[model samples]
Target: MAKPKFLIKTWGCQMNVLDSDKLAGTLMDLGYEPTPSEDEAEVILLNTCSVREGPENKVFTELGRLRPLKKNKLKVLGVVGCVAQQEKAAIFSRAPYVDLVMGPRSIMHLPELLEQARHQKALEAEFRDDSVLYPGGKISRSHPVKAFVTVMEGCSKKCAYCIVPFTRGREIYRPLESILSETREAVDSGFTEIELLGQNVNCWKDGATKGFADLLEAVSGVEGVKRLRFTTSHPRHFPLEAALLMAERPNICHYLHLPLQSGSTKILKAMRRQYDKEWYLDLVRQIRSRVPDIALSTDVIVGFPGETEEDFLETLEVVREAEYDAIFSFRYSPRPGTPAAKAEPVAGEVARERHQRLLDAQLPIQTRRLKAFAGRTIEVLVEGRSKRGTEWMGRSGDNKVVNFTSTGQPSVNTYLQVTVERAGANSLFGKAVTAKNEAPGAKCKA
Candidate 1:
């Protein structure tokens, strides 16, 4: 028999990205090779997300497009991630050609499920509690130097506008020992940066003994790990202790991704965010007090239902005051079965206009703040060369993209001191200030 081939299309957060790596590894260990195109693959997987209506509709549309390829071939079509968990039987009913529907936690069983699918079977396997543990051996890492470690799974917060709690189920932290062992293994296997990921990273509770601070401290002590980072913290769960831990640990990057869905207290309460404007601003102040150099990134949703002109201005005020390093701004789109979906939407034109205004207001603030780094020499971890051969591109400790030209080839993942020459709307243009020298025990990549 010929070796099976697989293609996975990822469409969600970092957790889904990590899940894709694990799935690819599982298939590779099961004697499968990854293919660049879905047409030639024996398995076509959609690792999907349902946070937005646009992405959710695309999943079904892609499945329909794949219909011709599945006609006579033994191709297995699978849908996995938040959408699969949310849509469940509805996805199969909409596209019966789909062979398997598995959620994020069910990926470990993918090889076995693929065999079942190949034999003309259709199945849905989703964890009701979101605590399913998979064997750790089979991860085909997409990046050699940076790896994502899932400290916790799921979100218990039933934010009125979000379907995450329903789709991903409740929050549950993975064991601390498992996380540490995995971190050590990743370091051993040539990964220097390990990012702890969760839906609400700060809420991580491992039994009664450990939380996010404890976890960060434990991971920092690992011998080979050089840099640490995390993502998607809930304002309601953003503990002061975590901020203190970051301030104390030199290994932890001075950055945080805290989402502020709306600026108005009324709108925030409507979204069930559980924190008000005063509280959010106070947290920011507290974090800055401890780590003044911290670069903050956030997610903002504009034109949510019942959002008034005053509410929109409130958002602008917050954006101007916060001056985020970068912002992922969105125009609110209602997903079916979500609370916001039932409410009347603001007009399309109005929503578009508001989103543009938010972007316009935030840009100048970012440029002004980014100007501070100009003329300074800082360390950048080389990811690879940029499109223009004259320069190499990498990220700063605060996750800012820095571009510079080197005298010679620079190894990826090794930190290089670079002097900033220029700045773009979002990145820094620079040149190497010092010669490339390998740090001991550093995991340098291509």
Candidate 2:
């Protein structure tokens, strides 16, 4: 028989993207080949997220649409990730056509679960063990130059509005040696950029020997790795030592994406963010003081329970002060079982109004930041060609998207020096200067 063909759809953050990769690897180990189109696949997996009701509804709707495919012939359908962790029974009850429903921590059991699904009428496998690590390489990355290495799983912080802690469980960081080994292996496989992924990456503390800083140090020492980056750091976990590490490592990108959910002390305290507006400002100041020219990004939630115009303005104030390179903005949505879910709801009209106000305040700030890069020569890791073909695209060390046209096709994964000529609200357009092999710039202060 032919190897089982599979198609996986992922929704959510980088952590979920890494999970989809691991699930693909698991399927590959079970003698499956990935199919580009879902209609042809024998096994269809929906890796989900529960951060918002919109994503949850999308997953449910997709599963309902896929029901006919399972009915006509032998096929397996699996739902994994945050939504599965949060609504296991409800998902099964509402969509009994689903053949398998597994949580984020239980996805490693997919091979075994698929076996059971073969004989059982319906398979509902939701195990609550978060410590298990799937052996590496069930599926290779689609990107030859970029690879995601998950250094930690789950979350310990039960933020009032987040279901991460309840869904993915407490933060359980991967062993430091395992992370280092995996990074080296990915480098050997021709990936030049390695992104360390975690819900709270900076909070990593696996054993007596390893913390997030130490993990970065180890990974930086690995050969063949050109760029190192991480994501979704809770402001509470920002340490002076970690800041120093970024400053000192040449390979580590000089971009920080610390989420500042709300700038008001009242909303922050209610959200259980642990850090105040002043504290976050101090952290930003420290990073800038240590490494000037370092780009910064953040996440902001505009309307929380009991949030007022003043509370929303405090957020705008922080944005103005920090002058972030980019921001991922959100309006609060009640999540079941989160502490904030029980609090009084913000009116939809009011929330939408606040969201638009915050966004309007950000666009010009982002535009100004990009304009500053104009006329500067910076090194970019080219990913691929843009849709128009007149431009090749890549990201700068600070994670700004840069695109430029070249006379010849420049190979992807290689760094190119581009002189920025024009700037847009989101991306930079430029002309390729030269392809040089020297180290781009000195290590920033740690």
Candidate 3:
């Protein structure tokens, strides 16, 4: 008998991407094959994200588009991830064709759920016991150079604007030894970079690894790992030691993505982010004191519930003061069941205007930042060809995208020192300064 094929469509954060990967691994374990194309698959899973309004809309739009597949003899059409957890019964009500609805907590029970859904309906969103490490086991890795190793699952912080807690449940840390073992396996597999993923990564505190700082220190010691990084840290729980560790460790990339959702102290208090503007600025000061040229990125919501123009200005003030390398700015979109949803949102045009203002404010700063790199030589971890394929592309240790034409086919997963010749709005144009095993200013080995 031919094995059944599955396709997982993921929309949202790195955690969702990793969850989709886990789903793929789980399906493979159950003797199901993965298909790159959706039409050929007998099973389709939508690993969702409900943190923001945009991704939530994407899920429904995609489901509507895939409605025809239900009649194509598709065995399973499941909805997984944050949206599944957030809109449990409503999904079946809105899109009656969906076969199964499982949240992050239900991931490990996929095979059983699939079997059950075959005979009867299944919806598994309730938080399960934390005794088992979530998303357990590792069967395969798709990337040759980059890998996202989830050190923990879920979020304990129930910020008013976020639906993560409702979807992902409480925070649970994976054992430190499991993380170390996985890092070693990636190294043995020739992967160079390991990105530690979590909703609030710096909040990690397993008994085996008491703090995220300790986890970074341990992972840095893993041989063959060239670069180490973590993501989506909350300002409230971002440990001081983690910043210091980033400064001390050469392998840890000098990049921090701390989300300062709203700049106004009152708005922040309303959002229950647990950190004020003063605290955020002070934290930024402390981090820059440790690594002065550290490339910083942030997530900003321009308008929030009860947000005033004054509040919007305060957000702009923080953005101007912070001078981030990039900002993922968004207009506040009230999500279902969150406290913020009940509150009156900023007027649509007003929100859109503020969103544009935030982007506009960041534009000159980002452009200037990229321009400053011109004539400076920086190490870039080769990713692959640029979009046009006329040039090679990679990221510097600071996480700035650099694209340059090479003499021959560029090798991925290698390192190169490129001196910036020019700058674009968000990326840099450069020429080779050195390649792997070559001295500074030496000709690149095609």
* Per-model CA lDDT versus the true structure: 0.83, 0.82, 0.82
Query: lDDT at 124 for candidate 2?
Result: 74
The per-prediction tally of clashing pairs is 0, 6, 0
Candidate number achieving the greatest lDDT relative to the actual structure: 1
List, residue by residue over 309-369, the lDDT tens digit for candidate 1: 8999998888887779999998888887888789998888999999999999988888887
Ranking by TM-score: 1, 2, 3
Cα distance off (Å), candidate 1, residue 25: 1.1
lDDT of 1 at 411: 77
Candidate 3 or 2, higher TM-score: 2
Q: Which lDDT tens digits does candidate 2 get at residues 16-78?
A: 877888888878877888898666798898999999888899998998888878865438888
Runs of candidate 2 with Cα error greater than 4 angstroms are 128-132, 387-389, 435-446
* Winner of 1 and 3 under lDDT: 1
**How high is each candidate's TM-score?**
0.95, 0.95, 0.93
Better of 1 and 2 by TM-score: 1
* Highest TM-score model number: 1
* TM-score quality measure for candidate 3: 0.93
Position 39, candidate 3: lDDT: 81
Which regions of candidate 3 are displaced past 4 Å? Answer: 122-126, 129-139, 435-446
lDDT of 1 at 278: 83
